[model samples]
Target: MTGNPTSRDYNKASVLDVLLSRAPLTRIELIELTGFSKSTVSRAVEELRADGCVVNGGVDEVTGRGRRSTYLDVPGTMGHVVGISFGMRTTCVLVADLRGRELRHVIVPTVDHQEVRNAAEWLVGLMAEASKSAEGPLRQVVVAVPGRVLGGTEIFGPAESMKVFAGPGLQRALADLVNAPVLLDSDANASLLEILTDDATLEDAALFSMSSSLSFASCIDRELLRRRTPAFGDIGVLFSGVGNEVLDGLLSTSGLLRFARGRGLDLERIDDLWLHPHEEVSRADVLDAFTTAMVTAVSAVAVTLDPGSVFFVGRLRPLVDEVLPEVRRRLDKSLATAPEVKAPTQVLGLSVARGAVYACLGMARDRLRDAVLEARRQGQHTEQSAPAF
Candidate 1:
């Protein structure tokens, strides 16, 4: 049976997440903040310490009673979480801890592209290298792809451009190579999640990435609004031939090629093209596209969720800055009647990889909490069921 989330599981994982995000907290503080029982909190903390997942951070000087007890800290190298972004051109591999700090990385050319065989062979080798080096075994892999994946199928899917993953058993084949649980998500979705990094304060945001190909992803109320074709945000497709069009038409590679040429860079193809946000040459072109695209994308969001901000997370930041002024100008021009679109358009690098870890780590943490809590509940039920002497 597929495991669905329980309220208890979410609560327990959230507790661990908060404790790990900041400095140590006393059992009293944890109880008050997490609304967990002192006894239950003690057990959880003890289990965390036993697993070596947490340690004594420091003692509270303000607490006058007793030893003032120490708080828990999640150290580096706690567990291995792998993030793979297989773009149109390159395969970027990053392995990190539960807190999302790097352990070892293997970033090589995208010689494989969409070919399952090519990617699987190269990735298998990379996995072996990572496994041998880590003190702990690989726990999970969160792979982000730059295409539309729907119904758990990777080939002949919504992403019409590339067909490399069209081969048989893409997920299973990769899992066989890594020997760990693997989670697959769209590059846009993964980038969006990675950039956000479980920050609940962020309610609504959209990310535009020119990694493998030009694409966008948006989240509303912190929940990813999905579709059958893994489609979240498609401003490139939407802004095509629209009013004062600035973005490349999704149906036209020539449009993207021309867009590249407009900035004085003639990239042969979108394969592994790392769109920088700061390069002066491409700055003007990117900004024009960013302005039109952001206006269209944010306009869509405005009509729906009306978010706080839109963050752009990718490799190129300076190039992104060039576009921000224009993006703001367009947003102002188009949404004159809509709610004020004042949120800054951000360009965050390597955020997608980090977000992938948080997403997967959150799941893994929830799983561990459930395993322990279920055992406790079972024990309690057994005690109540026993006959009295």
Candidate 2:
């Protein structure tokens, strides 16, 4: 109701921030940590509890008076968030709680040219299914796109199906379906967030997603560095110095499959290329070609960002072990200093989805905190206007 925040506003925000960051605290602990009076902490916690932002945890051990004190926490069940990652050939849907704990994760096949509306419809169903078992109502949604997102809505990329979900209209469509605000993030950026959230040791890193297409996301000092355009690290757009062809046209799985087809190989996809043996084009040869193409891309990134580590995700995970040594070798030759290059050992397929979940969880927490403050403010105003009888 006020144009500017008051001391009370700052207090509420502080309490919520502390509890959300380091939770499962008893009233006494919250008072000590927040430096607010016990009554202020109690009132703040009560407001948050009423707003479903905080919940009562199990009772703490008996105190000096032989009375057990109940601990309070920002329960994961208080709210739910969804993260969706769209690939050229597949889409991953993830549902998680306020605490960023994964509840459901599912991967579905997608057509490269599905209508934008059709893609959104498919995502709605997938999101519902993923959140079916979650404890609370969904609070926020984040969609990680594989292309350039201009002005926050217009997405330009080769993924034809995503055109529908490109701009503000996409957010409205998704928000209406899930009854929650939707966020859009680059898939590579989401992957970068996932790596940072999982590994605290990484202050700066580069994440390269190699699928039918290639994208790069970088982070510095635990923050996503902004690019000139929405899609900054799309390696696919770069010319590979080989004729007039782009890197995506030269090195992506789709490109390799085309090469296989041209060579009279029976491989229909990259996965098929490995499963079935071709007399003329061996898997070794295909891998060797991929390594060569990736060497150039990796070198470019290492020399530019000079990140602390380089991670390969997506379809490239299966080949990371073999690819790591080769890329490292190439980088060692090209750059004065090469970062640590390796493949993620876990969350291989769901990194982008996990990042989305984390992003949505953060949004949900902020929203819930604001709601708690508003409720408290309204309650105080009501008390102040009450007539003295």
Candidate 3:
């Protein structure tokens, strides 16, 4: 309480961190997990409880020697966070509490207008509607976009449908509307964040997204590599080695649809390529082309980064299974060693939103911690400044 406000009270912060990460723990468990002395743990817990940051989660069922140890947890009343996955056609929005529990989730068709203001209004409306179900105030918002994010504020080199989110206008508009800090990141990065959350053991891995956009994100040594300006992970620009076409124009859902249509398959939806019956020869040709392009792209990533695993996500995930065996066979034949290639267990849209929620939850926790520290500092100052009675 007497320490500098700018500096972290390690004991207090450690106690809160553990509770947030692995909660429902008894005081003894907290001391054991944080390696803090009994008195320090008790003091920290008391302060957190006083600040309404931590709450008693009732007593543990298992009885100890003297009394049943009480479980401690971070209260859901801390605040809520919103995660938005802004896609070309459909946008997914998720609201989660401080404990990262989903409160509400909705998928709505994206606005057709190219106006950034209109798009922002649409998104804000969706967020406000979803936030109604939240148990607390909104603390943070993270938006996942299918484009290059520059400086966490602007979208660059976005697809034509996503042009409405380009520049700083959308980010600024959302911040003003939501009254909370907004984080803009590529959908690929958002997917990677979700993957990391699900599997903490992943050190060197790559996620390839073949949805509306063709991009990938990588984790090296358990750290995600991001850039202030757009670079890397733009696999869409890589040549497909099939004439003058890039993977972006060859492997993306849109690109695949275009190719199928051009081949006289009359494919309207991506699902139609596989689900709808087309000329067997034409369908085979299209699938073969897709398989080749995907193999080339995945090989490029595997060979360059040597990632331990490569996960296929996005709209094309369904088709990936059909081509994966062939893709793997080709990769094994082409490279001395090939990383494990498989589809992620979660759906692409949900994965992106969930990942963004994870980021939002982290930011919200930091804000809460800082607020608690500041409040304590102010209380201490008030006590010191009070005239002696």
Candidate 4:
């Protein structure tokens, strides 16, 4: 038969999470904040300290106290984690502490974008320079790519995309270079997590990334939706036209430019749609088509996830003010219930990289808690197996 449920596990995790987020708390403060019994707080803190997960920060200064109290904190010397994002034109690397505070961040042009395999050495060199301030070996390294990552090894997308990770050698090289565990995630998925950090209201939402390829990440009840198919976010290639055309060819930045040219607007790039306001009348038709296609994809997401909110991320972010009204207008005419549409307010370059760092921080915290519990259990087993007195 199995032993009793690990019910106290919840309490331990709660206490540890608070400590990791805001440490150097006195016993009285922990007892008050955690709502745990005074004795329970003492015991938990003792066990955590014994496991080297928490350390005593000396006695707190008290002018009128009957007795000085000890403060406990998660030491900054615990370890560090790194998050990297590989985009179409640029690659961003971030080094952060276990608590997710940024120690360093660096952005560099992506070398040989079509052939990342040839630039593996350059990528490693960039990461090394970015992580120079790391106190010690990284606890985790999370890499976010513009394409889908399968089985933590293979990557799939357009031929000229982030296909370097499609092979296992690059992943292995990154792990070896950093001397840490590595995680691979889609850029859309990472961006989703980053958006949630700004507001607790976004428990469930969908992230629409309008980049080189159209992709999205859906979250339900604060948990990301995981799929087994690489085609889940391949909205770019989704069949649209009668014959050979696809969604990306109809609404992407490049696609909008092509549509404008067909209308004799003479626009060379998507940014021209906004940079030249005087030509707005000429490009109106192209904007209308762009908005229509974007709304159709968003409508599909709303029907599929019915999330509490839908966020616009990536390249299309700059076009939020220009297109939000149209997106809302279309959603109102189509859906029975349209979710709130939002654009990122924070200007953290490369949200995917920041999200990866956020995810790694969570993983590091959980692992540290598990290590403490395991150590405590072993200590108990040692006591039980000792010779009789």
Candidate 5:
């Protein structure tokens, strides 16, 4: 007769889940936390250890106890996950262990001219370089792009500079090169993942990436609202109240530069637009237009979603300090309820990569748990098939 599937598998999974959440715990603590008997916890830990999923940590010091307890933890040597933020200006890559501890972080300028295959090769090289310290093979990779992701395998509507990634080819290439599963998602969605990680209580929140392109993502009831449709979250195309200009044409970094140039300001960089002589009337005019467009976009999102909070991220983060007050003031004047608007604490590019890591951690955990259970079952089969001693 077949044994109950949940008998041992469920115990092992529960123990692993606890260690993943709170590691370096003792056997006594595991027994107490899981409400399982000592034998059950011991069996689970032994099986996990045999499968290389768990390892012994330091011994806990005892005050006046009979013995010292050895702490058990999910081993970092089990494997690692990679998070990549492929942006127009720069790409950020982060390597983290199954426990969510960062092992490597790198930021490099993006080559805008590379084709999909070339870009995949270049990124694989970077991933290999970043994961040198990882003791085991790569388990999962999540790539963040400034575009719409369909079914986590295809890319669409990427920004102009990153148009090379707009298709399923890049994801397929990366999966082939890395010999591991790969997932693609919008950079804005990745940012929202990072935010949700910081504060799990947040149910409804929106994020706006005001960089080379204007992108948006939202979390409703603690879940990211993802769609397979093309241009699903491209808030940049929303019509700005100003003379047929879309929000992207007026509020994005490129849009801001174009507006400044139209005002006769010879600005070569975004920094220059903000650092121009305070006495220049044209610079002030550009700021006014930028703030007006921001207020309009934010008010629309606030009224529609009624999110509890709104976040501004990416290249325009520096301008938040100057423009936020006006945004809030204008929203207060027009809307009955305005979401709390602010900038995230982490840098734009790194946050995208970190969020990708958060997005893949669950998958990695599931893979680990299944491997442990399978190893146990195989061992049992081998024993049953052996002749009696």
Candidate 6:
């Protein structure tokens, strides 16, 4: 009403940001955190309900109030979220609930810098198959790419090469195929969000993804400090190398197979994983050199950011199940006391896709919080302006 954009939108948005970040809170709690009066909180809640943004949950038993203080939940039917992650030889797809829960996941084969058209078409087909099984309302789609993205935020997708996929290239392609509002992000950033949700140490931490093609980094928190900053060491080039010595050029299935052939091991003839797994890796003294690379990355992140924790994502987790031990062992050998090394392990085996779902959930119900605050403000004004004796 004041014609100033910051008027109530600011208050409403702050209120929503808090609510969505945590479970439901009573008006008293919201008032204390938001600095708004109980009257304002109540008005916002009522307005949210009217707008169909917040759901009227059942009673609150802990407070022992005479009447139930209506709890709030984001309207689940607002839309659908999808997550995609890619590597040199594999790709992952995930669907999530409005709350960001992974409803399902699918993994497929891929190639390096695979053709854009092939990737887009495959995504369309997968979503179609998923919709056949979906039972609830769906809208709003988000995508995660495994490179640095060119945008206001640099969560994952490689920031340098992402210019190729940025703007209309990917969003327009996906939108034309899926017919929904699409947002792109660095897949590693999405993975970081998934890990932060479960890793307590990650209350303030960073995740370094050591995968084929390129490595990515993400700093995590309940709230972003700088979102993406330079201090968070960038390691993409090291992963996707230029010549034969490149990590991606060595560890990728093709790379590994090439290395095996040079060592007289017929990788094409033998299913190395199922048959001679030992011979497949004994090509050189680099027994789990990738593990060392990952450990080195973690140690670097530790000394650099002193993040509460760090996680190793991508193919490294599965290949070297002993990654935590290996990382700690290396860190211990390097430092006098390794900053109280704790578990950097996580089960985001398919987290990027889950992050996509979370991105959507955060987007959909994310606004419910504002609607609640708006209602509370209106209620306060109504009561305050009433005639008094």
Query: Clashing pairs in model 2?
Result: 153-166, 153-167
Best by lDDT: 5
What is the lDDT, from 0 to 100, of the residue 155 in candidate 1?
35
Runs of candidate 2 with Cα error greater than 4 angstroms are 1-3, 27-40, 60-69, 75-77, 111-113, 135-137, 160-169, 228-231, 241-245, 262-265, 276-285, 346-349, 372-389
Better of 2 and 3 by TM-score: 3
**Which ranking of candidates, highest lDDT first?**
5, 3, 2, 4, 1, 6
Clashes of each: 11, 2, 0, 1, 0, 17
Model 6 lDDT per residue over 1-389, tens place: 21332345456556556665553666667787889877766676564455444565555786654766656665554345666664444567777655554566777765333445656687777766665545355555767765555442233334333334434465666777775567776656677777666656546666555453344544645543333443233453344222344454343334444545665665663236334555544543343554555555555556766766565565545544544576577777886556443434544436676666676667656544444334444553422332010
Candidate 3: where are CA atoms >4 Å away?
1-8, 63-66, 370-389
- Between candidates 1 and 2, name the one with more favorable lDDT: 2
Candidate 4 lDDT for residue 175? 64
Cα RMSD (Å) between model 3 and the true structure?
A: 3.5
- Tens-place lDDT per residue, model 2, 1-389, is 43444566567678887887677888888999999998888776765665556788799876468778888888765768889887766788998777666788988786554355666777898888888888767788888877655544556564433455555666556666767777777777788888888788899888777665666778889888776575566678876554455667656567667765655677766777656556754556656666766676767777788788887777756766766787678778877887888788645447788888888877777776565456445554412331110
For each candidate in the order shown, give its overall lDDT on alpha carbons.
0.58, 0.71, 0.79, 0.70, 0.81, 0.54
* lDDT pick, better of 1 and 4: 4
Name the candidate, 4 or 6, with the larger lDDT value.
4
**Model 4, span 1-389: residue lDDT tens:** 22322535446656777788667788888988899998777766765565455788789777974899888887666778888887776788888877677888898776764454456567677778987887755788788776666655556773245545575666776666656787777777888888776567778788876666656688988888877877777777765432344667655555555667777886666677677763666666666666666676677778777887888776656666688897898788888899888877644345688988988888887776665445334443311232010
For model 3, how does the per-residue alpha-carbon lDDT over 1-389 read when each residue is reduced to its tens digit? 45455323556767777787788789989999988889888877887776676798999776557678789987777778899998887789999888888889888877786687788899988988888867656888999988878777888767766666678888998888877799798888889889888887888988877777787788899777776557666778888877777888767888888877888988668888777678989888877888888888878887788899888888887788888899899988998888898787776567789989998988777766565556545555322332010
TM-scores for all candidates: the values are 0.72, 0.83, 0.92, 0.84, 0.91, 0.69
All models, RMSD in angstroms: 6.5, 4.4, 3.5, 4.6, 3.6, 6.7
**Candidate 1 regions off by >4 Å?**
1-29, 47-69, 73-78, 99-101, 131-137, 151-162, 166-168, 198-200, 229-235, 242-255, 260-290, 313-320, 337-349, 376-389
Number of the candidate with higher TM-score, 1 or 4:
4
Ranking by TM-score: 3, 5, 4, 2, 1, 6
Best TM-score among the predictions, by candidate number: 3
**Model 3 reaches what TM-score against the true structure?**
0.92
lDDT at residue 96 of model 3 (Cα atoms) = 88
- Give the clashing pairs for model 3: none
